[model samples]
Target: MAVAIRLRQEGSKGRLFYRVVAADQRFKRDGRFIEILGTYDPQKKGENTNIDIEKVNSWISKGAQPSETVRSLIKRQVKAQASN
Candidate 1:
């Protein structure tokens, strides 16, 4: 089955939160996921994303594609890691 890395919505309506997950491409968004990779909180300022790069790399190497937004987040994480 095709796989993807994407976000799952959660938290209250006005206060949105999301979990970054690895799941089957055919599954509905926010439905069954293979694993929880990390989180994204847009409401929070600075450092709002937390993802396991090692796990993400493993998934990507295994052929899991990330959504557009998730792709950007991953880029940011990589830059952050490189600086520190």
Candidate 2:
């Protein structure tokens, strides 16, 4: 099955949160997922994304394609890591 790394929505209407996940591309955006790689909190101040780059790299090496938004999130995480 084709796999994709994407976001799964959670929390209430006004306070939305997301989980970075690896799942079958055929499934619904918030449906079955293979793993929970990390979390993203837009409401948080400063560094708002908390994703495991190691796990993300593993998924990428395994041919799991991340959506454009996820790709940008990964980049942001990487940059943050480097600055620390």
Off by over 4 Å in 1: none
Best by lDDT: 1
Q: Residue by residue across 1-84, what tens digits does model 1's lDDT show? A: 999999999999899999999999999997999999999999999999999999999999999999999999999999998998
- Candidates' lDDT values, in order? 0.96, 0.95
Residue pairs with backbone atoms closer than 3 Å in model 2 (clashes): none
> What's the alpha carbon RMSD for model 2?
0.6
Tens digits of per-residue lDDT for model 2 on 24-61?
99999899999999999889998889999999999999
Could you tell me every candidate's TM-score relative to the true structure? 0.96, 0.97
